[model samples]
Target: MNPWALSGVVLVAAVTFYLGKRSSRYANTTHDFLVARRTVRSRRNAAAISGEYLSAASFLGVAGVVLKEGADALWYPIGFTAGYLALMLFVAAPLRRSGAYTLPDFMEARLASEPLRKLCTVAVVAIGVLYMLPQLQGAGLALEAVMPAPAWLGAVGVTVLVTVNVMAGGMRAITVVQAFQYWLKLFALAAPTFVLCVVFFGTGGAGSAGSLGDPAPPVFREDTTVTVETGASFEVSEETPVWLPAEEGGQRVWLPGVRYEVDEGTTLRFPEGAPVPAVSGGEMDNASWLRPAEDAGALLGTYSLIFATFLGTMGLPHVLVRFYTNPDGKAARRTTVQVLVLLGLFYMFPVLIGALSRMYVPELLVTGRTDAAVLLVPSAMLPGVPGQILGAVTAAGAFAAFLSTSSGLLVSVAGVVATDVLAGKVRDFRIATVTMAALPAALAVSLPVEDLSLSVGLSFALAASTFCPLLVLGIWWRRLTWPGAMVGMCVGGGLVLLALVLNVLSEYSGGWAPWFIEQPALLTVTAAFLATIVVSLGTARRIPDDVNAVMLRLHAPDPLGFMRDRAEARFGRIEDRSRKRGKHRK
Candidate 1:
């Protein structure tokens, strides 16, 4: 009743997943534990990627931005989906071809140096930790909003649950779980959206809607108003207050201050004490960009979001690691495409829900929890038992979102920790998994003080700074030596660390700050890419010939040895047919 949908969703999610624990036993071998035994089909793997990729930021945060900013919110989803396309075109096949379990493994082989490997390992762990914090914080926020639980309880519960699942099952277990969670998230969002749309328009189609007459025009329900003292001498009553109450549910709901609509470039200000007015179609442009500071930016915001999404996907260790789960490079490529389509389809609903919320759940604006827009939209739009059922579905979706992404992040971290930290040193893989998973829980406790999305964005920027350069160069450039990789990682990683430090100090010290958030990714990534390239070019003479052969093996399916045999088995038949054809022609 009090917007406890998030808590109910999280509880149901934990229980559903807990009951499904036996499924984790499927991951038995190191390969299975690391990459789901490299047998994940294209469609399912794609869905899983899309599932994990669509975090709370996309589902809830972006939509809230749209409610406040208008068209700009559309960019978050567009950029996210398009990023998968980039993965499909550039990174997917090559990454799979690398035949490495973790990014560190790939770095070790490519750079042929332990130091580079260590750098990669540290970066992987750092990025994973950074990424995990938001999911935990969002989980806490979701739980607190949905249930009567303390925010920290949500974080603790999710961290523990995710740690257990990831450590117990590893990649093998998480693959299945993420896949199931993806469909669950889609269903949860889709089911509620469909019902809400019906409730919004009643039995009639869009043209016969009750609220705004034919093809209901979007309306704003103001929660708080800002009163500006212009110091103009005028009659108080005749001078109309900038904001006014609109009759809704038999009460005059008013916003306190001057409200202006930004239709294209025109500003339509509602004079003080005027009744809140509804604008149709073209007229709604006045209020467009003036609603909130977060929403007042331009399309550049979308492009920035997209840049982060597309590049960020390549840098995400969990998403990249999934490429290893494919049977071969081709399957990996196929999986990326599948993920793109699924991600695109799933995104459409959130944008709609957020847009719809602009009209119905405007109360969230007053409540200081616009992030809860996704969960609250269904309840606010659809009344009675139907609304309750829809609310449960939305809760389930949000829970699935947290669970899937959190599971993937934890699995990626555990993999890096096991292979790099505890490899050969730890007697048991299970023990290693537990240790790796628990460390992030400690980090999650410190996240609430920061912005969750920005934390994730910084993780992306850092990721782009370090890995994006490392990956593109590793795959495309042949001259990259160990020294190049090591130096490049340091340059990129250092920049990211520096940006983060500056941001923290600025917040703590209250001083003028640098362009830490705005351009960190662009600068760090460029420097790292350039450093790697220049260093590799300088050391080209010492480049080994073995690299070509290894790369060939990485890219092409050899009949005798593909990932210890799987790739070649499929290609072996093709080679045999060619030989037979030659024999027949002779």
Candidate 2:
């Protein structure tokens, strides 16, 4: 057990507790809990949004994917940051101008349909839960790397801490905590990265790794010994010499390059600059790893991934809720601009870490545990105390990613449950938080873990299919009717939901799941747009009576006082400006 890593994680938890406790007093109303009373300024709101946006996927999964898939994995971070562009261009200011606390609130207010609102409420919770699974998976990986504990303990720890924080002060407390976490995360990743780059490059270690364009697979930077903890099978492209463990007679042998299956507890030692073995006998090849595959299915999946991320940002419930905390439409827009800059800055560091890990931690590739690339890189590159300290910093950053994103998502889910299912009061919100968090927490512990980035992609594809079309058309198109919007959402959302269910079944049943089922974003998003347009045109006469008024409000400046209807009929006490305030003689 590394004391440095454990202490770093504990320190981060202590800080989170302190911040959440300090902000607990001000969350006195639903508005404060749901939207921070719409009083957060642009700069701080941007930091919180970026903080929550950079989840487990960004911190750990991206690096892992890069280590496994090479250049193709670069698309994940690119898509993640680019998604914000869609929000800024189409959704941000208009959604904030609508003055709604949640997605369901907007649906009911925009179309004047309670049924549509309820439909969206279900969708929000589904997306929130799906998104949370990956965060917990990442949390587990981080803790398990540094300490001798079961992976489920890390999952439960994150779930419990986030639930307590969200239940304590809701969005008001989360805002401050998330913003602070963003800076800490930035420092944690940045400081170690600076040192790693300087030491590795300045000390002439760079020349041994070779270029990305090198035809041969990556080589071990130095003589290294590795043992398979579970089991792994990998292929070699060239004859390689490996020294077996002492129990296996401790002899070195030249094995022909072929698919070799290894049992658990197998250990091997490779000499310095030896070519790394290829896993799955495909992308691990140096040139193949650097370029896109030529297969049609692979091409289609890539497009789906790009669309899922590019269009999915505006649709994410947790991300969308941050905009509502902005005081006005302009602030929301400004905050998005700032978020774009912050996110772009943070993504490059993880990419560098992944690239470096390829040379230093080549054994992870053979073992199919590339997700540990980021956590292991610092130690693999630098040995002993210095490496442990840097690894601890990274583990802390990973925790930040888990807690911030999980808290934001839990709050969003709880708010939906409180407003849609319960009495929509502060008390209901508190109860809903605990209730909403419980199911995901249990599932995170019991369910088998998945690749964090891929799991997050499932949520993005679902969001893109369902909410992206609704927000874009709802704000811009005056001819949109409630029936049309409902049908479109059902068609698009239903496909993705079905895909998710089938994907889950395939895991247990050993059935073949197609690429489209795993990544339906491109197809579903197009179907949603087409369905919404066709259905609306057919039902043009059924448009809302106040369509023009709503459109004007969505587009007009906030100071004009025509920005929105708050839909208080369902979610009462969201804001009560006429209520008396406590006064004192000054």
Q: Specify the highest-TM-score model's number.
A: 2
Model 2 residue pairs with clashes: none
Q: Which residues of candidate 2, in runs, are more than 4 Å off?
A: 206-213, 220-233, 240-274, 501-514, 565-586
Q: How close is candidate 1 to the true structure, as a TM-score?
A: 0.79
The candidate that achieves the highest lDDT relative to the unseen native structure: 2
After superposition, the stretches of candidate 1 with alpha carbons farther than 4 Å from their true spots are 1-11, 14-20, 203-286, 290-303, 424-428, 449-451, 504-516, 557-586
Clashes of 2: 0
Candidate 1: lDDT over CA atoms?
0.65
In the range 413-501, model 1's lDDT, one tens digit per residue, is 77777777775222345676666656766666664434345567777777777888788777777777877777787898898788778
- What's every prediction's RMSD, in angstroms? 9.2, 3.5
User: TM-score for every candidate vs. truth?
Assistant: 0.79, 0.91
